[model samples]
Target: MLMKTIFKLLAVALLFASCDDVEPTIYNGNIGQNDTFLSFSRSVYLLPVVQNQTGEVKVVFNSSTVSDVDRVYNIEVGFPEASPANPETFTVPASVTIPAGEYQGSFTIPGVDNGLVDEVVKRFTLTVTNLSDNEYMDNDTTTINIYEVCPLQADFLGTYTIQVASEPLGISAFEAGEVTLVEGDSQYERVFNATVYPGYGGNQQVTLAFACNFLNLGQSIDTNVTCDVEDDTKSLVHAPAELADRSAYDTNDDSYFELTFIEDSQSDCGSPANTVLTFTKVE
Candidate 1:
């Protein structure tokens, strides 16, 4: 009797161990003929190289399976680039077929510049499938290497009167108000107001000329509005007429511009950041 009881106890212990090693094949209503996961493998594509400045990207993944489960096998992938996540989940048709051989799922991805790494090279992949049993699969993977590009600046060289509008112009900027082609004639009907820098600048006169032809792309604007740095006595003449007729100039990229009494500070007459001042039409 003692021997029989020991044998029975041993048998129960072995059965429990086997149960522990085995994955639960059935849940409340999952893993049935309508809920089995298909065993599969797939390939995904990440950007060969990423582009910067925009900081956005898109990718795709293709997956397949060998023995499809019951209902249908939902699919998903993982990406190291975005966030750490669990296996992706999807719902399949109740009578979906794994084609008796293979299953496929292709995903399209979209992203934005998150300031993580601009124009940088990073990598990520897909996490494959999620099982209803909480047990999931991760296999599909891809990589993307990003490269950042800089934007081109603008040129702002000419004679002009500076105006303040909606937003502040980053560099020493100027805006055109009206054009008097010559004396006693005007083009636009805008009101003449106080100059931007009241006391800092000279009093409003009959005509003002701005020579900003030297301001071009890639040039830095002079911060201090001075007649002449060395000496105020050697200050160049201020032209207001041209300043009023300043043309609309902008840089391909967000760049700087200059507005100096003397046209000695501009660089790259045509490139972004530099412009030449030509205050003609001044009376």
Candidate 2:
């Protein structure tokens, strides 16, 4: 009876141990009985540029091989026949080489110059072929998008009614004012000038410097704004320096400004009061 009981315990332990060794299977359709497979590192790449730039595309193997010598691979780049920026606009390498015992290789596309003034997005495609070894290329291709950075200045330069308020402090019903954007010192800069009247019986003239880009509307006027609230009295408001957070947008032929201003010092009204300003372009 004792020997039978010991055998049963041992069998149960072996069963639990076998179950613990089982691993979840991750299905990979690209991997087959062969150990070598080539594929692009990414499917899409966005290249934003104003002048000339270089972009790289990487080719990786599923598994590294112990090669004594370098292996070469041929790649083909295809561009839209109707693309205005065609072969003359860009150049791609004909092939890439992987060093011995390496699992990856890269190809460079050079001389990507945006000479055209027209703001248009261009794209090209790449495929891997002609493997030096008896390896297979995965059924995948990569697409490269080239975007020209054209500043949208004309779209945002106009007069608009702006309303400034601080709801938490019960400040509202302010007088409407106009804001305008003039050409700045550079092609990417804009001078933001506005005069706002607050319900708290004070006039604030705001002059901010802004940066313009193709990705979105215009960004903050400047890093900070110094306002002379009263005679011989000046206050500073910390503004966002980044483009995305502190920018204005245009929709349906109307320009809009949604920004927050944080005071640098305490005032009689309040300390650290957040002021939100919203503006709409007037026809």
Candidate 3:
């Protein structure tokens, strides 16, 4: 009797251990017929412009069995239905191989700056072609967006003294103080935090882009300061000035440039459009 009990306990322990070692099989739901599937790790990819102007896209092999030898899969890269990117602007690999005992691999996509317009996003599609008699799963296709980007120019980033040169909404909406300009997404943009309305109790990150001294004001940011007593949902807003003169920056002197913006431009506060805050650099 004692021996039988010990054997039963050992059997239960082994059963639990085996269950712990089992790996879950996540097949593409579109094709439940197959035990193995090939999929892109992401549905969308942003190709960052690096030193070589190239980026890698990861491909994952979802299978319970790991092969001892490398497995190669064919891929097709083409433009989507309409408004496809220029064929000459980008290049992708024809095939990617997963190494022995590895479940994932990556393929390099070379960025070709062949007259590609800066800041224009172009899209291309990548599909894994070897699955289930050429029938692809939903996850097998991935879209990639590429754009021409110039390197960040270092001269524009730093701390500078700021003060309102013009206020169309009200007085003291922004205080005269120092603010820092940091790097933005592309070479033409800069980001900074300004407390446009202290009564609202938060500083909003302001991003502005410029080309040839012409300013591109970013979207309005929510100050979360409700001006309407009836509607708590309505809050004050701040954005780069839409005014023509203040919107333009002075390229002749970066040390003394100006930032203009409208406070309560949306008229959330009853006194909207009363102030347009223009900040001039002092440093």
Candidate 4:
């Protein structure tokens, strides 16, 4: 009889302990907000340099509230103080209209290749105006850049003997061996892989940009080849060594081409200036 009474007492305690209130988690903040605004999708747009081509720059308008009527907004185009875009090279629309029951719309800025120079980048600005019903967002204005490019007249795709023609600092950038040239994503570009440092494990992807008889190493590449064993900070880097007179190719000749680049461009080890490499097409 005493054991039965003890079991009943323990059951009553457990039941009372499970009855404590949890108190629902009260959220003291708003779940969402409704905002209406208009702005450009991007701050900068780069148009390709193909001849007789037209590029499109898109603008986006955003809104949270829907209406039964169309919403119209005005746009103003202007040129920056330095390196302004020529008026004849591009066209911008004065206004854009968004249909009702839509949250977004897009408009294009038509950029023509006329009057665009081969090596120069032209810039223009577009600003949103006369938006009475919607607020202008952070990126209200956007800049567009246009340039000219010469089409590839001939193919330079083949294996070639690449040699370190000029290494002023006597640091051999690569082993004089055969490297294959392949077509890049565009007609004005050719890509190859080579070891920029003597003992680097892998080859680095290198791009050569050609424009109107002018060619250069497209951009800087990280070799990951350190100068010293103890110093991880000092590494060899390669970048475009653009020589006005020498860094060029003959469009009529596909047999050979030369490229120049800077080894240890930032002088991580020392002042190793221009490293000129020659590529002779292999028959």
Q: Best-fitting candidate, measured by lDDT? A: 4
Q: Each candidate's lDDT (Cα)?
A: 0.27, 0.43, 0.54, 0.62
How do the residues 109-176 of candidate 1 rate in per-residue lDDT, one tens digit apiece? 33333344332234444343434563333322233332222322422122234433321113222334
Error of 2 at 106 (Å): 1.2
lDDT of 2 by residue, 126-226 (tens): 77777545454444356655544433434555676767655433434235567675543233334454432242233332433322232222221111222
TM-score of each: 0.22, 0.39, 0.46, 0.54
Q: Write the per-residue lDDT of candidate 3 for residues 108-167, one digit (tens) a residue.
A: 676665555344446788877775453334356777756443443336668877777654
Order the candidate numbers by TM-score, best to worst: 4, 3, 2, 1
Q: Worst 10-residue stretch by lDDT in candidate 4?
A: 1-10
lDDT: worst 10-residue window of model 2:
1-10
Candidate 2 local Cα displacement, residue 241, angstroms: 25
Pick the winner on TM-score between candidates 2 and 3. Answer: 3
lDDT of 4 by residue, 124-224 (tens): 88777776643435456767665666766678788999999866545457777888888654566678887664544346667776766777765566566
Misplaced by over 4 Å in model 1 are 1-44, 48-102, 129-283
Candidate ranking under lDDT, highest first, comes to 4, 3, 2, 1
